[model samples]
Target: MGTEFLNIKDSVDAKNLIQEYFNKYYEPEGEEIPIEDSNGRVVFEDIYAKIDFPPFDRALKDGFAIKSEDSFGASEENPKVLKVIDALEAGSYSKKTVENGLAVEISTGSPLPEGADSVLMFEYSLKNGDEVELYTSVTPTQDVGKKGSDVKEGNLLIKKGTVLSASKIGVLAAQGFTTVKVYKKPNISIISTGNELTELGEELKPSKIYDVNSYMIKNAAESIGASGTIKGIVKDDYNQLKSKILECLEEYDILICSGGTSAGVGDVLKHVLDEIGEVKLHGIAVQPGKPTILGVIGEKLVIGLPGNPVSSLVIFNVFVAPAIRSLLGLKESSLKKVEGKLTKRIHSAIGREQYQLVKYDDGKVEPIFKDSGAIFSLARADGYVNVSKNTELVEEGEIVEVNLFN
Candidate 1:
């Protein structure tokens, strides 16, 4: 039996329904992983500093460490002279203390001497043998970095649910953390279904095309921190397709099948979902990807996307990517976008949201109109423009928001 198209859902409502169902039943779990492998992963718990950063009063400049009282009122006109007592490099400490007429030569990051309270920059001081003349007055604690001033012990470092960046990794290293707790990546299974699909290494036949959706979808999943594997292709056979999907659901958190989602006689993905599990959504009011399917089987989410490369990618970016992020407790706006002006007018179906592939030029976006099934449709474009379902025509020179594919 053909699936119903009379009740195709609005794209926004469909996404909301998926999110609500996910929040009700799914809870993301966490695991401890090495910091080296934790980049881009969401933090599972709050992290705190175990010890104070710097851990000691350090020098902020390469100059002389001295008592501010001795350098007080000193200037270029009448320089103050002091004997060098000792020299301290970075990671070294001084045993001798600075007296009234003595100074300690200190390098940046060197611990402040016992009796020295300020650092005099080398530019402001002149050295002749062991005696130095200070030409500028320095206040107490000037150019001195105090311990615990930057990061105090037991202070919160990274808050829960924050995405770990390279800078955050450095912060964890400062806290002496070799490993961190992060949300576990969702495991996904991708199956490309079509009688006209062939493997990459196989010789091309007139009627068959290489399976691009499987590999493309796999990388798309990986982009969102989800581990995806191609579970091979399933031809247009109801029994075999149903068996493979059921088997995949047993081992994966999400099952994604490309093709066979339309209302044609050969499109049996929706029927298979109905037979084995729940078909939550049959179609969406979207251009190029109106034949999308969203369902659930057992505890796993099952999604069927169109066979066309451009349509498959658009649907995954709009639906699957966000769903994967939500399962991992990540924000929906994780992907960044830019806004630009349209170079020309574009038309869209009044009742369906349209995504047109476009190239961004000096602040102007030029739409790329090509066959959806052609690989060059998206290859020549930098990003895509979203036109609302109610928007029938977009005029030239209009400011439009562009969603980059990267």
Candidate 2:
């Protein structure tokens, strides 16, 4: 087993380095999925409108559809009276055409009657028997949605690599798409190491802790549309850990193991991966999670995260999460963030980058101080502020951006 920590990279440098590898070697595969099941997935191809939005000229409000010239010179005192030939509601089409002194009553979203050039609101028209009296004049296309006004046929509605959200799904549905082509989600296998770790629902022995990192990382991957599995726990034995990882690498695109990553005597995850595959990086210059390992065996990527629960989750968020997103063909620029004022001062070392867990309240944030092993440490945190490696102190009342967990 290799005990030396060589080629330790800066946090940001490590992410870019890993991302370049994925971009060069990994090509995202696509699958057709029902539009209802596409939310949170990435669109594999550009989606163009099959038909013009609205499909036809439609009424924007409940009104009388008429030729604009017919309502010209009309006033409340001396109104222009037109015979109502037909009435149409939403989803209903009118066969009757507005010609000469004839008009059609139309509801919002109803296709405009043939030959009608404009609509006069009901407030500006009085209905008596079959006649509608227009009290005000209207211009062409006034209160009327023209055909292809919203979106034109063959126009790009969604670009390739766009994340499928509820609104994006609605756009696809509006175009009569029942299914869409989307990038396949990556399969990630998680293994928690350390003999001191106990499975949930098992008896808690002295000096033993419940497994938390595995579940946390699994859910995090799931949130980003990756399929994740917990492969149980492995004691600090090299052979057991190596075999499990080797087996998982055959079936999974990414393997993540929490614990046994730090350079302690018992830390064997890095050594095992190094022996079987290649360890690209064994450590990062980041606080609380400096002992992260990035490696590759064949085409599969393996990550060894810190044993501490908080550190594991934080490192996963900063590095592993983005990598998973990249596997799904998502861009890192899509990460959402918001700026807030820090309620208190935050101090960090000058060399290593730091991510301070914080609680956000009404645009103000305060650091969450908890031990790494505390179960509620992350639960109480709403987000984190990434303090760069070059800076030392973020003074109180300073504005900083937070990347929310959600």
Candidate 3:
């Protein structure tokens, strides 16, 4: 008997099912890695500042460090002259304090000497033998970077579940952190199934096409911080497909397969999944991706994507990406959405939600209508617009929301 979809689920219900199932089985663990490798990883715990930034009062400009009161009445016409006791460059300290009539020549980033509360820029002062003339007055703490000003001690620097960026890594470096605790990335095994598919770098046969889904899906997973491993291609054979999946499940946290998921006689993925584990859902109520399959072997997720390259990626962005993000303790749907008016009218299946690929430019959204198998259609699209399942036709000039690709 040919396999058939027993109960098809709408897009919303399907997503909810995948999320709920994964959340129940998977919990991300934390790992300590060097700060150099922490970028793009989620923080496993809150990080706090142990000490004040700057740690001491430092000069912000190259000039003389003096007691502010000494320059209170100084001006260009009648400059105040003070004995230059010592010179302090960046990374150096002055032993002598700035007494009532004394000044210390300090460079930028040098710690301020005791009793010196302000810095006078070199432009406003003239250096002579043993003395410097100050032409401008300075207030207390002027040009002085105070301790704890940038970051106070015990302040929460990075919150748990925050994704680390380049600047965040710099902050950790500033705190003298050699390593950080981050949520471990999920390991995914990607498999492509089709007799007519050939691997890249191999000679193309008469009717075989090079595999696209494995590489595309791998990069897509990596873009979202998951570790994807391409398990190469497997022909449409029941025993071979089942054996490959079983092997992947033994090592990977998730398994993603492309093709052989429809109701056709040769589409044996559903049957293999049924025999090995459980086929949770066989079909989705979405145009171009209705043959998608969701299954599980124990705690490992096995997803069967449509053979069409465009459909495989679209369904991935819709369902698999979010599920992976959830496992990593990240908020799903990070893609930005913008409002735009359609350039022309379009038709969609009445009962199945449609993800109409479009080229969005300057508030004008032009729909790129092509078959699901057309890879160029996805390449030409900047994003996609979701048409509701209840709606059949969208009139021209109608404003719609476009979800921009990352």
lDDT of each: 0.89, 0.89, 0.92
Model 2 stretches astray by more than 4 angstroms: 340-347, 369-371, 388-399
Choose 1 or 3, whichever is better by TM-score. 3
Off by over 4 Å in 1: 1-6
The prediction achieving the highest TM-score against the true structure is 3
Arrange candidates, best TM-score first.
3, 1, 2
Q: What is the Å distance of residue 396 in model 2 from its true position?
A: 4.2
Model number with the top lDDT: 3
Encode model 3's per-residue lDDT on 303-391: one tens digit a residue.
99999998998899887788888877788645578999999898998999999889999999999989999988878898888999999
Per-residue accuracy of model 2 over 1-406 as CA lDDT, tens digit each: 3386777899979888777766765788999999999888898989899999979888998999999999999999999999999998889989887898999999999999889999999999999999999999999999988889989999999999998889989989999999999999888899999989999999999999999999999999998889999999999999999999999988888899999988788889888887899888888998778899888888878888999988998888898888779778877787878889999998989999998999888999898867666669787898889999988999989999999888
| Cα distance off (Å), candidate 1, residue 52 | 1.9
How far residue 355's Cα lies from its native spot in candidate 3, in Å, is 0.8
